[model samples]
Target: MEQLFSKALSVSVRCRDSEERKSTIRVTIDLQLSPSAVHKRNLHVRLTDDKDPYFLFTLSISEEDFQSLKAQQGLLIDFGSFPQKFIELLELCHSEQEAESPRFLLQLCSQGPTPEGPSSLSVVETNAFKHLNHLSLRLSPGSDREVKDYLASCLARLKEEREALELRLKRTEEDLSRQLSCTQQTLCEKSKELEKLRSEWTSQTSSLSSRYSDELQSEREKALELQRRLQEQADQLRQELESAHRSSSQQLRSRVGELEVSCRELTERKYKNESAIRDLRMKLVAAEEEGQRSKQQVLSLRRDNSLLDSQVHEKERALSQLQMRAAVLEQEIKDKELLMSRTKDVLEATQQQKVSLEENAVGKDAQIKKLEATVKSLSEELLKANNIIQKLQTEVKSLVGKIKVKNTVTVSQEKVLQETTEKLQSAEKELHSSRQQLGTKEQQMCALKEQLESTVQKLNESREVLKTNENVISWLNKQLNERQMTRATAPEPAAAAAAATSGAKSPLYPLGRATLPPVGGALSSPADLRPTTQLDVAALDSKYFERVDSIPIYGLTSHLPKEIPRPAKASLPSAYFSA
Candidate 1:
């Protein structure tokens, strides 16, 4: 069956009069079977060309015209045959002379205003009002009081919206200011850090230059000392050679004089006596033979002296070579000393870096341990929360099962579940936050581990360098001992060799002490040779404890519910007691 219907369109109307530029008026239309029925249906058709700020007017038409217009879809009505007000509205909406677009819109609404009150109507009825009614217009304009009330309500709503927008704008401004201040503080801190780094760099450069100059001066001094010692040794050797030459010449002169005297005596004896010629001749022959023997002995002595002179010349050449070798060894020792000094400086720098890294590691370990404790606590809380949730669920199920028998208990259980749910939510939030914190700390630990590995690599490199230097120094010491043995006589050379060994031991003592601690737990140094500082042991112990404390373990019963429910009353006790 076809159903009776009404339709209405509410439109904000703008009209330009001769004096006024533009005026806004609210217009509503209703189309139905009768005027009385339109009022009864609260179908007010409000339209006005009045000068007031607000107005309401009603227009009602017959059912025949409504049906005819409804069949035509009502979008393009024949305003040529309609009322004057309707024609005026259409003209105002489609005026060609108006430069500006229409400032009004049409809203299709289901219900219209009535004399008694506002009434709700079906969409079919409203559509009928718009589409199929005859032109029998009956208008009821709203009183000035009603119009003033509507305007007042609209103004109040606008004021409230304006205040709310202002409040939001102020909050945004505050947030921006807070962020700006935070950025400014961070920038200032960065600038300060930059300046501090620049100053440290300048100081380091200056110290490096001074150390180089000092090393150069020490090397020069060692060279000059070596040269002076070589010169003294050369002068003493030349003097010893000259003295030996003078003594040999004197001995040869004395022997020659003695031989001349012997020859003279023999000549005198031969000339003085001829009477005892035969016996004297025999004695003289014996004396001449003895003299010849003595001369031969003297010649042998001269040959031995010449051999000694050759031996002395060879010793002098050996001494000169030894002196040259000693000079070379001294130069090498100086170089080794310089290298050792540089190694010591590097070792000290590495030690400081190691100490700092250890300290940072210790701090991180402590933080990790603290986070672990917090995580443990959070886990406990979560377990407790979960246990509570389980209890609540069981209790709620029990309560729901007996809800018809015990509404009061059900109500109480509901409240308990609500509280438990809130607590569970809070616990979960804490767990999430703890998980985030753990992730961040783990990242820090990984970064620290990387830093520690890098430091260990640097330390290993330094240790190898120091070890190589020590070996070179020891070799140089051995070379020095060899040179000393060649240059100095037997007892003196022995003493010098002992002294060289002692000198070699001295530098190694400090080098071993300095390099040992940084290479802890590594077999770089023998157990006996490692530094025996109390502080180092204490620091190691502390680091070990920190590591051990960072990790945590849980027990199976840690999350168990604290309370157990009691057994219910006996089922057959009442009947048994009665029997």
Candidate 2:
């Protein structure tokens, strides 16, 4: 197992310059050592910085002291106790020529003991030198008298500097007071100026308001006059339109009567034409029927002629078969020929009758086309009359619409004028209210300034009280210390107990009795103690604890009681110590 301990030391190195002047520099030394090396009767020490510029020399420990350090790790070994060993270590670092010659000779002096304690050396281990131990030597300040004198001089200098700062602070405070007075005067003057400006603004606003009201009155008068004029004009236009409407209506009635008479005459003529057309259509239908009958008759006559020819052919064949009947067949054939000629005449008569009926139908169709043309002309005339009536009605409606638009425009203009006047009045009211608000805000600012001045006075008084309290607290701490010393040095237990009982009744022990635990008992927490009012100094001797309950000491009521468990060391605030 490897065990190592590192010791930190402050090293003082003294060296001579080229002019033989001695100078010293203090540097921290870190030493690390392994216990194994010391157990083998060999001491190896290493430094944190092997190439330290200040500590160029070498150091070592004796075998006995090395063994002792191994056994007792906390032991401090002083190099000054063995000057010969230190000198030998120094000699090993310098050459013979360097040591004998004046230019390179090294002078090493061991430091004497200091008032604080004896100067000691520690061992440090380094990885660079595992088989050897290096040492750094340092000396503390020599005596306590010299240190006391130095501290006294420093305190005197600090006092002088503090007096100078106080003087500077006083001058600065005086200057600030004068500036504050000047600012206060300027603020008063500005307030007066603001009041004057406010009055002038109010006067100007009043004048502007009156002028605007007068202008509004004139505008209202003009609007009323215009309204009256528009009404008169509308009345005149209405009368004129009524007269024109009456005349146009009479003329329209006469024209309508004339158109009605013409329409009646045209309708009567239309009825007569319609009757003639119907009669012609009926005759044409009858003739078409007669033509159909004549067609059938012609077809019948042709069939009869074909039958007579066939009979004549049959009679001639019989005559050839019998010569004695030849005369009878010839007479029959002459009869059939007469019958065929009579049928051909009947067919010709029927074809002529069909042609005559077709001509009559065509004439009737021509008459119907002429009647439709006349009816179309009459309808066109009626449409023209209807368009004229519609135009007159549209013109009358346009005139009425123009009158209504004018009336609406005038009414809207009157309403706009009233709304503008109301807006102006509201603007005036807003300006008045804003001025009032500004005055109120200025008053509030003045009140705030007065409150700030009062608060500053209160703060100054509190600071003075705090200084007095600090002085009293220091005095109480000194008293508490002296009492503790007396109690600790008391000889006999019976006497010490008597002294403790007496001290508990004393005014200085008023808080100690409440805070301290009973003999041989554990201390109770502060929360069990009840808070009380500030102690009255005059009542300390007579009425220390009027009530039986424990009262918490001032300033020791919080975590202070927990932190300061010993009653002898715990110091209460001035309120409890004041007498």
| Model 1: lDDT of residue 25 | 41
lDDT of 2 by residue, 1-579 (tens): 121323332232223332223233222222334355432232233222223322322223445454344345533444333333433443443223233322222222333332123333322332343523444333343345644554565579789999999999999999999999999999999999999999999999999998899899999999999999999999999999999999999999999999999999999999999999999999999999999999999999999999999999889987776875777789889989998999899889989988997898799889878988976865665465446546545654554565454452556555554654565456456555755776688799898778767655644544454455566556545555454555557435864665566556764543332232333344254333222223224412222212232233334346322221111222332234443
Residue by residue across 1-579, what tens digits does model 1's lDDT show? 111222223332222222212334444344333345322232235444335545445444444334454455553553323444453544444342243433322322223332222321111212323532222233444567866775686679789999999999999999999999999999999999999999999999999998899899999999999999999999999999999999999999999999999999988887766657877889999999999999999999999999999999999999999999999999999999999999999999999999999989988998999999989967876786678668767866665676655443567767766776786677678767866887899899998778767655644544454454456456444534443344344334655565456446653332112122232243232232222211122212121122111111124125423321222223322211131
Candidate closest to the true structure, highest lDDT: 1
Superposition error at 497 for model 1 (Å):
12
Give candidate 1 regions above 4 Å deviation: 1-411, 483-579
TM-score of each: 0.18, 0.18
User: How far out, in Å, is residue 276 in model 1?
Assistant: 99
TM-score of 2: 0.18
